[model samples]
Target chain A: MSTSTTLEAPKSGTWDGGNEPMKASYGKLMMWFFLLSDAFTFGAFLIVYGLTRHAHTPYTGEAEAFTFSTEWWPIPEKVFNAFPGFHGVDLPLAFVALMTMILIFSSVTMVLAVEAGHRMDKKDVEKWLLWTILFGATFLACQAWEWTHFIVGTDEGMLLPDGTTYHGASMAFNQYGPPLFANLFFFITGFHGFHVFIGWTLLIVAFISTVNGVYHKRGHYEMVEKIGLYWHFVDLVWVFVFTFFYLI
Target chain B: MAHHIENDFQQTAEIPKPQTKAIWRTFFILVGLTALEFLFAFTMDAGTARNAIFIILTIFKAFYIVAEFMHLKHEAKSLIWSIIIPLALVVWLMVALLAEGSYYYESITNYFK
Candidate 1:
């Protein structure tokens, strides 16, 4: 398929006259563009998050001692205090921090895969890609646990403006605080989770292709590098989300 | 036959060596930053100062990820500028919206309550 392009003499120049004006492969450059656009999408979400959050009355409750109310925004640590296997213990930011570590580690593995691809070390590529996929799934699973806790909130439900107590959070109501909080939480994290799912699926495909020696036959592992760009972008988005959503 | 084969095959560039050491170094830096952020989140009181610190640290982490993890730092200068220049607009959007949002908050507190 690519033979015709290679038939011509290999042209060379940094900026004066090369086919790759940016010194990057066409696929890689296109992937960078795609990621840049994706960054804007996430940026908009997080900015809107900041705007809406600022619009709400700031939470002024003492640290770790908070109650749900509609009068102001709920403290993030108080809201996301649940941890697996630690029932009734308020471990604020711990689980989310663990999730952050998982994602960062996974990004490490992904870059390793890309590095392996550079060396055309197919076995290492397969190994690191598998590790990346595993970590991605683990992050998703952590998110699922978090969502479950969010949806099935604390037993001591808060009183709504209507003088009725409501438990848990849905699109219509939130036991934590304002409705916008739940909305942004579901939307921002949901959007990010979907990206992780898609990236995970792409990693699976890349892993399978590596196992089948597809890139081996093609004489280049550019596909792994492209997907690596995507996977790293996902991790990059999570760092901001970790700060704006959970931490700040 | 050899010359014909050489002409038929594409001239593949030399593959670059893997920088595992740099990768590990970046990973450690990211982890340390995250730990520091966690510390600040808990120790510091909720205020503009804490929030500003968080934003600055987040930006630092972002720079490392983009430059090292995504390999944007090693890319051609033209490519580097192409990506970073557009993101400045996002910063503009943020400042504008934040100012607007605070205005909304003030109006709500003054009138709605």
Candidate 2:
């Protein structure tokens, strides 16, 4: 009957602001702090990426004479040139664009769901929450398609005239871009995608709980607010990804 | 159990209301900037100009996301500064390391030549 059960006292009692708990709800507040720390970790990754990119030889001039070929680190456009059903059409960076839109739209739906929860509009909450889940699923589907497009070349997975497949990573080079670019791309986005998967699972659980009248019985929707924070955090990280990885 | 409607109602009253139209306006601005980034990437010859355009647009989008979606603009000045200052530091560190690394790379390549 009460949501108070979800709150617990910290061992140190440091969070005890007099009678109030040091934090808010145990689960929700902890998620916020966790996201803040996670933000720092991603910051470190981006900083390292910038450093490595700076160290790489630029794609021009006398430097080309010293290397095996003047091709330089494959430009991001040259590397990620994939789209559905346009064989060799050179639709550079199309897939990443779609991924970006998917992430941003999902963030929109998440905020809407959170808004509905605040209004205590149960039907709106259910609808918007379902929409949020659908958007998340769509984003994941797009990511999978992007990976497939990356791995198997544009059509029938044919090799280029250079005798290498259209998509594959090598120590010397990558089909989509420089080897480091592809490597970091997979690592960073893959980790973020994993977080989305986790967020989706939490959202689904919350949706089911709402259907079962859990929040109705408890008289509050703080759980939805907490999950919304996590969802928004994911969108926030993608903003940086779009900037540093895609744009720059 | 006593029903503390007074406190509960007061808390509810203090919860800031969503400015729907303002949020929509900010969202459109973000989408517009993203379009500009894509256009620059596609149209411009790859060079310093393209890179500058991308970085500028990215900063614009970041500003909107933080100010609008995260509601940092509505928060206390201390809270705003707390988040912004650290973010600025991170960006500075990234740029500094990148510039220094580039210089070192140029020197090493020239020596080898």
Candidate 3:
């Protein structure tokens, strides 16, 4: 049996790019287009990040001369090591791991929601959508806490040779290493957080429509499926961000 | 509750609850990958090898997300290539930019000395 019912040609008709290209609706194709371009933007951001890291080492000049290294990039392990409510304990990546898990779980919830859509189960779709929204919101709350900790800074600031002190991440002063690290962190994570907020809002819209019987009347849940695509794309982006910024 | 109990052929065919075994399997795989990633962060020191391992795992997770969760794997071959083909350029962009950036860095360090 063929994988797609729609893609199977009529008994013997000439093939043409019909209303649905390769069995995908216009909206689905458009969403894929938007996601593809968005991926390019993220690629550019990460490439720039790698570029900066290549240019700037921990020390300024050669080791023999030493000569006051201007580019003092901090090791990521040092800056992002604390867990919420566990003061004085260094949990390097536990919080981020939790956040990653939460987001991955949300993606799973979204897949279940889409699967429910395929079965035309409005109630189950709504239930799973709500769960996804809850997971997404939890991830956002964790990010807010991480940002707050970074700003308020439990760790003491580092001292430069000139008697100046570098405090926790601001655009100007970076306690971690160079100010650039802080700037990238703010830009990358802040940008990603904004996407999460938008995704949550979209989930609410989908949930409302599901509750209102919009899809039930239409006898299909393609809208839920479309939103699922967007939601999963967000999780995919976070996977890359987590690998590059946090791990490496 | 109105149309739910009807014995209409189409309605009966569209079961209200589909088996979710695949979904549960997917969840476990993704979570397991993440658990392994977390373990790596703790056990392994940062370096090229560690970074390579992270990237490989990330690619695995990405494949699972796109193929399984997004259901693109179920779609037609043409549609899959339409998206993947353009993304290959992003890889070229990274290599080009980073190589030039590193070259400039080598010059800058030499000049500073």
Docking quality (DockQ) for each candidate: 0.50, 0.30, 0.63
A1-248: candidate 3 lDDT, tens digit per residue: 87766666545432554445478888888888888998998888888888888877654343233222235655666678889899979677788888998999899889999888888877789999999999999999999999998987655566678987655667887667777888899988888898889989999999999898777777788888888888899899999999889888
lDDT of 1 by residue, B4-89 (tens): 33322322444456769999999999999999998998888888898889889989998988999899999999999999999998
Clash pairs detected, candidate 3: A60-A69
Ranking by TM-score: 1, 3, 2
B1-113, model 3: which lDDT tens digit per residue?
66654334544565665778988898899999988888887778667888889999999999999999988898988889989999989999889888977888889889779
| Reference interface contacts recovered per candidate | 0.76, 0.38, 0.79
lDDT of 1 by residue, A1-248 (tens): 56565466655756557467788988999999999999999999999999998899987767657779988898888888889999888788999999999999999999999898877777789999999999999999999999998998887889766787888999988999899999999999999999999999999999999998778667788999899889989998999998899888
**Which residue ranges in model 3 land beyond 4 Å of their true spot?**
A1-19, A58-70, B1-14
For model 2, the stretches where C-alpha displacement exceeds 4 angstroms are A1-16, A19-30, A61-71, A154-167, A170-173, B1-19
Best by DockQ: 3
How far residue A103's Cα lies from its native spot in candidate 1, in Å, is 0.3
| Ranking 1 against 3 by DockQ, winner | 3
Error of 2 at A76 (Å): 1.5
lDDT of 1: 0.89
lDDT, candidate 2, A38-59, per-residue tens = 8877887787777777777666
Clashing pairs in 2: A15-A22, A79-A176
Query: How much is the TM-score of the A chain of model 2?
Result: 0.79
